[model samples]
Structure formats: structure tokens, C-alpha cells
Target: MQKKYQKISATSGIMTFDLELNSEISKVWDLIATTKGFAQWFPELSIGEPGVDGLILFDFGNGEYEEMTITVYEPQSILEYTWDKNMVRFELVGQDNKIKLRFTEEINEKTTHTPRDISGWHMCLEKIQGILEGKEVSFTEDEFLALFDEYQALMN
Candidate 1:
């Protein structure tokens, strides 16, 4: 049920996509707004709650941990949060038999931003795109080490 997907690219202060999915708002929300659903793609994540004061703890078991605070949550409508001072928002627009999922991840320091997080979201967004079309997959974290090494190589 994916209608359109915006390719991810590095920007001066952020990296994100404006995605369109052709699925029920409830179903799509369940995937992104739930712990188990998120763990499907971000295997390193251990979500606490989906409330305003909740925290998303993601640890790839590689000595790195990402902590994000949920500042806003409105079921299948709107979700906003902060990660390392970066504001991440998910705006849900309902359409006929589908919903438009807009994701904007803004970080002040792109050069210091973690590529692992970006790549993880990259894979997650791709799977979300596929899942809505009934061709989804379970992206794993077994590639964390390799991906970390790869990112380091790219940076150096």
C-alpha cells in the first residue's frame, strides 16, 4: 500500500523522507508507535512506553546507546520526539484506504550525527514502505558491527 517514498539524502542539518503509505492509519501506527513493531526493524531498540515522557533506548550491543525522549504522542495522528537535541516528528495524514507518513529528523550537527542511526532508519523506512504493500521484512541488527565499521571507513 505504499504510494510514494522519498529517497534519503544527507543535508546540512538533517536527513529524512516524506513517505506515502497506502494502509490504514491504525495498522501503520501500530508498526511505528509500538515497541514490538519497532523492534522488527530496529532490533537494537528497547522501547519503554509510547507516552510523552517515555524513552526509546536503543543499544546495538556495540557500546553505543541512543536515548530519545517522546515529547508528543497522539495515537495514529501525530508523534513527535527528541533525540540528542534533534527533533523527530511523524505527521500522519489520512487518505482513502491509506495514510501519508511524513518523517523529519533534524539534528543541529550533521557532521557529528551518527550514521548508524541514519542507516538504521534508512532500512526501517524501506521496510515500512514494503510492509504496507504486504511485502515487508524483518531487518536485523546482526549487521550492526559491519555497518559500524563501514560507516567509520566512510568517515575516515
Candidate 2:
């Protein structure tokens, strides 16, 4: 899997980067739809949606959890939804044998950036990239814990 952009939003006006992967839409879709698929990368997700109108709820196990309501689950174009107060959109396009994905999370100014959310998304997308391109991601459970700890530190 090729990583075009991987970093935090250190710029004004744009706090997120656009990451595209090389894979089919079906493979990409499965990563977002199935609980087992995401569980491979997201260790805090105790409950998740595998269908439309489904809600994904996860606790970082710090007596805090975030819940997102599913809004869209179209096969090839979009998967848009509200996770907590943040609005996330995933758009897909087919380029030959590759699936170009755009994952965007638009947050209100009132909403401060939580590192846990940031790191979790980062790891998950990386795993997705690996899966899409037929590469192995070395994201172990302990690795997830370390990432989560880093995020928690940033948040607090």
C-alpha cells in the first residue's frame, strides 16, 4: 500500500489530509462495514455497525466512549455519517484495479482535536491501505495500546 499523505493538520484552514489507496471498492468497503475487519486495527471498538442505519460505538476504556450514527452505506460512492459531533465522509472511486478513497472528518471550531480520535483514524486508515494493496500491517494489540496512550496524553 502506498501512503501519499500521513500527518496531523499543522496548517490553518485544513486540519485533515486526503489519503488515497490502491484497491477495489469491495475490499475497501469491507474494511469499513465489518466489525472483524476494523477490529484488526481498532482495539477499542467493542461495538460497531456492519450495515446501514447501524451505529458504531467504542470505548477507549478510559470511562469514555464515542458513538457514531450511520448515515450512508452505498457500495461504491459514499459512506457518510456523524460520529459523536464530528461529521465523517468516505468517498470512493475506481481507477483501473485501484480504489481511490477520501476520508474526511469535518469538525466544528468548538470541537477540540482529541488525539485518541486522530491516532485511531490514522492507524485504521493505514491498515486499510495495507489491506487494499495486499500488504501486511504490523499493527499489534500492544501497538494499539501505545497509540491510544499517546492520544490520551495529547487530549489531556
Candidate 3:
């Protein structure tokens, strides 16, 4: 899997990543669109409902939750939601017993936090891929920090 980061401007850009998984679309969909499944990789986020205008809860690990709105939804295929000032979308396509998961984030305003967010998402996608491949996955701060540095370099 390769990750693509595009800088549209000093304030806006896009990030895209793709994963080819030997799993059912439904399984991938659950991991991306449902609370329990998403928690396996990204524990801080969860979906509240199953359609557009639904809420995606962001748990701060301190009993506080931020409500993010779902902007698009399609069962076992597409899911898009508001992520802070950006937009995050996951698209799934199945072919020949494998599925391609495309993750895209539209960054409305790139700040100092952009690299951190991108690196976080990069690891989450890898975790998802590992789990789907029947492998146990764990992340360390050092690993994240190293990756974060790599993304931060892109910002420069």
C-alpha cells in the first residue's frame, strides 16, 4: 500500500490512500462504518447512525464527546463524514474476491496539526489491513513519531 499526499495550497490539500484486502466488502464496511468494528483500529471514533446527517461520535477519553456529522453513506460501499474542518471518506470496491479500500481526506485548512492527523490515519489504515489479514497489530509512540516526522517533512 502507498499513500499519496497532495498539497493544494498553504491552507488546503488532499490525502489519499488505498488498500487491497482479501476480505469481503461487508467486513471492510463494518470496520469503517460501525462503532465496534472501527474501535478495533481507531477507538476514539464511532458511528451513531446509518445514513446521511447521522452523528459520528469522537470520544476524547475523558468522558467528553464531539459530534461529527455524516455527509454521505451507502451500505457496504461508501462512508463520508465531517472531520473537524475537513472531510473524511472511505470508498470500497470489490472485484475478483478482493476489495480495494480507498481512504480520502479533504483538508480545508492545513495547520501544524495536519501531519499528526495524516500520520494517525496512516497507521489506522495499516492496522485495519493487518487485522483483515489475520495478523495481530500494535502501535507504539516511537513508530508514530517517526512517521509523523516523515509527513511533517512533506508539509515543508
Candidate 4:
């Protein structure tokens, strides 16, 4: 499925993507909410705790870690957390047997890293979809760069 991206507010710097997956809500929930499921697609994800106010550590396997705090947690429905100067939110909705996932990133300001982050999220979503479909999929650096260029042009 083609992903949809929208600018919630240019002034507020909010951006969002709506993704539809051919999977059940429960499966989708696991992929986003559980540490083991998260590791399937996001190999660097490690959570100190399992709920709200917990520490989410992202280790790039380079001995460097980016820590973020989970601000909201509702199993199988909502997951939100602090990401640097912004907040990332994931909302899941079930329709029949399929699932709809809405991802929102609240940006404080547009920076050089904005497009990079957007592209990364885009790839992540794709990876999640692949996992749900039982397909081995990943994006190369070149694919990311292409996606980054697309987001950069869209932002401009």
C-alpha cells in the first residue's frame, strides 16, 4: 500500500502518515507495543520498562544510545513518546480484520534532520508491513536517500 503523509500544521511543524495494513489489530499492536515484536523490525529498540513513563532506549549497535520517555501507553490502541524536541505517536484502529495505523510526529521546528527522520519512519512502516505479511524486507541506504529526497521536496 502507498503511504499517505500530511502536514498537520506548517507553523506547528506537525507531520503525520496514515498506513493501512492487511493484518489484524492484535498483530499490529504487538509489532509496535512489545519489545520482542519491536525488535523484529527495529532491531535497536530496547525498553527498560513496559508502559507509560518507561525508558525507551534506542541502541544503534555503535555503543551510542538515544533515550526517550514514553508519555502515553494504551495497549493495542495508542503509543506515544518523547523523541528529542518532538513527540511520536502511534494509533491503531481495527476495521473488520484489517488494521489502520496512524503515525504522528510533532516537530518543534523544521531542521536539517526533519527529512531524514521522516524518511526513516517511512521505511520503518514499510518494514513493519513486510513483517506482518511474512516477507523479509528491508531498505538500503540508497532507498533511504531516495525517500529522504522525496520528503525534502515535499517539505519544500
The candidate maximizing lDDT is: 3
Candidate 2: misplaced stretches above 4 Å? 1-15, 46-52, 59-66, 109-116, 138-156
Query: Which runs in model 4 stand beyond 4 Å of their true positions?
Result: 1-12
Candidate 4 C-alpha lDDT tens digits along 37-153: 889877788776868998778887889999899999998899898888889999998876788899988887768888898898888888898998888888788998999999888
Candidate 4 structure lDDT: 0.83
Instruction: Report lDDT (Cα) of residue 91, candidate 1.
Output: 78
In model 3, the runs with Cα more than 4 Å from the true position are: none
Instruction: Give per-residue CA lDDT, model 2, range 1-156, as digits (tens).
Output: 222222334321212435676666777766766566666666665336644777777776888877777788776677777766666677778766666777766643223444556666767788777766678877677887787676445434
TM-scores of the models, in the order given: 0.70, 0.64, 0.96, 0.88
lDDT of 1 by residue, 1-156 (tens): 222222234533445566878888887887788877776666676667778888877785988887888898888887778866567777788867767887767654455446676655666787887877878665567776565555444433
The whole-model lDDT of each prediction reads 0.69, 0.63, 0.90, 0.83
List clashing residue pairs in candidate 3.
none
Off by over 4 Å in 1: 1-12, 62-65, 112-116, 136-156
Each prediction's number of clashing residue pairs: 3, 1, 0, 0
lDDT of 1 at 113: 43
- Report RMSD (Å) for each prediction in the order shown: 5.6, 5.7, 1.0, 2.1
Measured with C-alpha atoms, the lDDT of residue 65 in candidate 4 is 90
TM-score of 2: 0.64
Candidate order by TM-score, highest to lowest? 3, 4, 1, 2
TM-score of candidate 4 versus the correct structure, residues matched by position: 0.88
In terms of TM-score, the best-performing candidate is 3
Q: For residues 56-139, could you state the per-residue lDDT of candidate 3 as single tens digits?
A: 999999999999999999898899999999999999998655999999999998889989999999999999999899898777
